[model samples]
Target chain A: MNIIETVSLALRSLRSNNLRTFLSVLGVMVGVGAVISVISVGMSAQAEIARNISDLGTNIVSVLPNFRDSASQSRLLQMMNVGLGREMLEAVPALSSVSAVAQVEATLAVGGDTARATLMGVEPSYSKIIPTDTAFGRWLVIADLSVHSQVIVLSSSIASELFRGIDPVGKQVWVTAGERRRPFVVVGVTEAEEDEPASGAGRQAFIPVTTMVYRLLPARNVSMYLGQTRSASDTDAAVAQLRRFLSLKSVDPDAFEVSSQQALLDAMKKVTIIVTSMLTVIAGISLVVSGLGIMNTLLTAVAERTREIGVRKSLGARNDDIRAQFLVESVVLSSLGGMAGMALGYAGSMAVSKALNWPPAFNWLSVVTAMGFSTLIGLAFGVYPATRASSMDPVTALRCE
Target chain B: MLKLERIVKDYDAGDIHVRALGGIDLHVTRGDYLAIMGPSGSGKSTLMHIMGCLDRPTSGSYLLNGRDVSRMNDAALARIRNREIGFVFQQFNLLPRETLQANVEVPLMYAGLGARQRHRMSADALRRMGILDRAHHRPSEVSGGQRQRAAIARALVNSPSLVLADEPTGNLDSRTGREILDILDSLNSEGVTVIVVTHDSEVGRRARRIINLKDGLIDSVEAAADEHH
Candidate 1:
């Protein structure tokens, strides 16, 4: 028989046993639903991480001091433990690719509001290399260093809390050392960064590097330094260049670590992809079971319709016709079940995304993949049953009660 | 024309070799109305099944239209059954889920006709069987005679040259049985070869030729009065 007639007949038979049909289709639906939901969760999480990291500017690299040790040692001893220095900062300019550099200490501060802020000792090129600018005033510069000027730039939070609505630039602020106090002019107030859960370390103050080294923190030392590159992709090469420069200057091969922002992001992506793949594979198990359910159902269907087989055979249906009819019926059922499951999966994933407030990820590839898998299930499951039915002897089938 | 030459069919029922047909030779030309009669286990049904290409003879050649069909494979036999032979089972064998029209349309469906052709042909066949008014009704909704008539319509749907009825009247009351017999008689008169297998001698006496089977062998062949259409 032709496809249309075969399908109609199959549909009629299925409808006659509506409960069985529903039960069979339910297996596929659940399988698809599980797969889609899992994929969506993975996609949404990936997007969220990517957006969060990219928002922090992938070109900006933060240098944290390898300070697992105590901070009370002498300058020479701190230098011995300290990894990076002026050699690294000066070599950044030679890379032609390294846009700017800044060295910072965590000890220097402004009082009554003396807090442990990253006291950056930067050049005027720091503004050119990165995009840092004062919201209310100006930052320290080379001119201040030339005069050994006692000028500093407050972070937006410290300036607001200490200076209290006053533009701190050109205002005198107290910088205290042991048994002595000096007045330093606040030349700038840096802008406060947008708060994010992932980047909570964006607040800091700027000072002339010469002044910071000679005037303040002379007892401790400059340990950590930050670098910026012309492009996000250049960070790796710039880090390599800086590492080579610093190692040559320090004569210590393993003194410091040069980590790039892109490398970190790539690592995160790799880890996430691995997790997502594992999840997808785990969900695939349910799909395979669903396919097996379809096969079992078709097998039972062939057994139940033996006499129907006889009737059709006697009515001029060839063995191939019988085979085609059963095969097509199976495909139709599976494809329809696949479509419904896809719809269910879509809705379920969307609901999960909404309930979790995650970024939505509706993967058409996943849907198509699900459909292909489900169709395969039908084919794999239906083949044996169709072949068995086709192989039935017409005479014996007619004689079957 | 159909011919059975020394047909033999045997089955090994456990330890015993039960013979269903034994050296039974018979012949009938086109448009012949023949009845096969036997008591239970007498092999009359086996003879009908072999005649309809539903079964193969063990050691004999059965010819249809001058071709040996006994040695044909199952698929080839099914093809001949589809195009050249039509069957009416004792149980009517109507697909209960299908409407009368759809039931009659099955053979034409197997003919690979398009939807329009199958529908038209089925309607025409149902009309000839005088059940056109109930074409949309399911077999469960129709009477026994109507169901048998639907079966006859389905059998003729492909316009087969021969109709095989295996105890066609067995499931019906006397009136419905007579109604079905009359339809078969009329179809034979219209140049369709008709073979009816029955255990009732009363039914067998209605055919133009009666072949009696006993102990798997042909016991007798007697000519009877021609059935009037």
Candidate 2:
């Protein structure tokens, strides 16, 4: 018999009993839907995290001090004790590949504004090394350094809060320390990042490292930090130079922790990828369960049609022909269920994307895998029932109730 | 032509060997109308089963058209049953779920005939039985006589050489049974071998030859040349 005829006959049989077929296909629908929903959420979350991390510049490296001091000192004083001082910053620029250096911390004033901001201390090359866009006035110039200019750059949030929507450029602000503190002129105002760290958003300030070390916080020691790199290919060279210089200055490499932003981002993505793949595999187990449901249904079908089997056998249908008929029926049912499930999965993914406000993207590989899985399920589950039906004896089957 | 030589069919009922057929000799030529008569448990049905190749004789050689069919496999027997013999059971064994036309098409379906040819043959067979208009009606919707006629139509649809009727009229009324017997009489006269197994003497006496079996053995063989046919 032709496959078309067999499929039609099988479909007709299934159609004759609508509730049973629907319940059977329902298993596949739920399995495919679960798989789609999980993969979509994982992929979207991964993409979002990767984008957020990459927004930080890839070439930049951060150096945080290992603060270990006696309890008698304040926390800020202890932090200052762990820092690499002005000697390291002065030594870095003389090296051929060293690009720029900057360091930042908080100094709070309760009089004019209660908010505390990062008190950045940097050299003239800080603007050139980092891609900080100036919104108003000018960046710190070389003339400022020659004239010993004690000038500060106010970030947008600090400018708005401290100056009350007025441009704070050219304004003199006193950043008070214990006894000796000086007034610094605000030369420029830089645009603030929207998603700045919670600790760095309220009061804006910047000045020369020489001025900050000599003037404000004179009682506490502050560190000199490096934040720059060479070209992409020279990244390793820059890191090696810094390591060698730090080793020459300090007794142990454990005195500081050095990390690259790009390395951190890559590591996070790798971990997320592994987690997503594991979740996908767990979802795949449902498909296998759906296949088992199809097998059970087909086995029951054989049992119910014993008399029909006998009639067909007595009429001279070959064993292969009987097997083929039942097998064709099973495959057709499973394929139909698969097709329905794929459609449902597509719709489900689209719904999730709408809910999450992410771009809607369909994975065709998922459809292919679903189809292949359904076909295999049909074949694997259909074999036992087909064999049982074909192996029945005409005499005993005819006598069956 | 068909021949059964000293057929013996023994059934093992636990430890006892109950003989269903005992050294029975029978011969049937082309276009013969023969009836085997016996009461219940007289082994008339067993003999019919052996003659139709649906069952095997324990120690007999069955020759169909001079070909030994006694040792044939089940598949070979099925092929022979589909091609060379037609059976009409006491219950008028039409498929209850199929339409009359589809029921008549069953034999041709196993014959590997194309759909169009099978349909045409089934419709023609129904028309011969004068139930062509009831072709689309299921067996449950049709009368007992109509169902039996439809069964007879299906039996003859393959144009087999022999028609084995095992109590064909047992489920029909007397009038309907006479009508069916008339159909069988006409089929026999048209050169088809007909073997009717009946307990009714009136139905048995209509055949050209009657063989009476008792206790799994042939009690007597009588030739009634003055039958209706």
TM, every model: 0.85, 0.74
Poorly placed runs, candidate 1 (over 4 Å): A59-86, A89-134, A139-219, A250-252, A355-358, B12-17, B226-229
User: Residue by residue across A1-401, what tens digits does model 2's lDDT show?
Assistant: 45665686688767766787887788777676666656766676667676676565566565555556543234434444313433444444422222223344555442367346777666665665455667987777657644557787777766666677777787766665446556777788887777554344544466765556555555444453545554444445545655666656555554455566667777887887788788777877887788788888888888988877766665566567678877887777778878888888788878877887765656777777777777787888888899899888665665566
For candidate 2, report its TM-score.
0.74
lDDT of 1 by residue, A1-401 (tens): 65676788778877877887877788887787778777877888788778777765677554433433354223224553122444455567533322223344353344445544566766665665556778866766668867667887877776776767866778777765444455778878777766512212445767766566567654435544556676776777777786776566545544556676677778888888899889888888888888787787788888888998988888867788888877877777777788888888889888878887778998888898888888888788888899999988788888788
Candidate 1 local lDDT, B1-229, one digit each (tens)? 8989999999887999888898999989999989999888999888888888888999898989988999998778877888889899999999889999998888877766888988999999999999999999999999999999999999998888889999999999998898889899889889999999998776787788999999999899999875462
Question: For each candidate, what's the DockQ?
Answer: 0.74, 0.32
Candidate 2 lDDT over B1-229, as tens digits, reads: 9899999999987999899998899899999989999988999988987888777889989999888999998778878888888888777767666799998888787788888999999999999999999999999999999999998998899999999998989999999999999999999999999999999987887788999999999999998765475
**Each prediction's fraction of true contacts recovered:** 0.81, 0.23
The models' CA-based lDDT, in order, is 0.77, 0.74
Of the candidates shown, which would achieve the greatest TM-score relative to the real structure?
1
Q: Which candidate has the highest lDDT of all? A: 1
Error of 2 at B109 (Å): 3.9
